[model samples]
Target: MMKNTRYITATVLDGNRLEIETPDLPIGQTIEVILVIPETLQASLTLSDRYAFLKLPIAERQKVLSMQAEAMIEHYENNTEWKDLMTGDIVEYSEP
Candidate 1:
């Protein structure tokens, strides 16, 4: 049974599909991930602050681009910020 929201197991794997595994969801259900990088930003890859790809490290930039990265973390939650896991080398996680 599902214990609590705090209970979770994180693993690292690489593949084509999205790696999200929310607890209790049926395995075969369909999901979607959209890359909404603005065209203006795409056209101006040299710019920072607006274009995230230009600001990231080479490897991280590859992953972000490969994923066709979408919205900035700020778009989801006001208080939450997407720290550059590659550049910052800072990992933030909650105890389960």
Candidate 2:
């Protein structure tokens, strides 16, 4: 039986891949993944953003690059904006 559900917001890494952070699950656990891409996020996926990103210096560009799973988890660990699904409370967090 399923234990609990957790909601996470993450950025897409490479094409068609999402990076999210949560507590570790059992080694052999079976889970489902559902993605909801917002329209604003879709707009950011356009050629202009790609071009702008490409124009950035390597160092700056790397900063904007998508976070890997490990990095995403680290970011989540330090994040204050993580919402509570049970109580519907919101904590403010801003990316550095």
Please, what is the whole-model Cα lDDT of each candidate in the order they appear?
A: 0.49, 0.61
Enumerate residue pairs that collide in model 2.
none
For each candidate in turn, the TM-score is: 0.24, 0.33
- Writing each residue's lDDT as its tens digit, candidate 2 over 3-40 gives 46566777767886777655597766787654434545
lDDT over C-alpha atoms for residue 21 of model 2: 57
Worst 10 residues of 2 by lDDT: 62-71
Task: Give one digit per residue, the lDDT tens place, for model 1 in 1-96.
Answer: 332222233344676433556866687856433344455557755556546546667865665554443333434455334534336556799999
Separate clash counts for every candidate: 0, 0
> Candidate 1's error at 19, in angstroms?
16
Best of the candidates, lDDT: 2
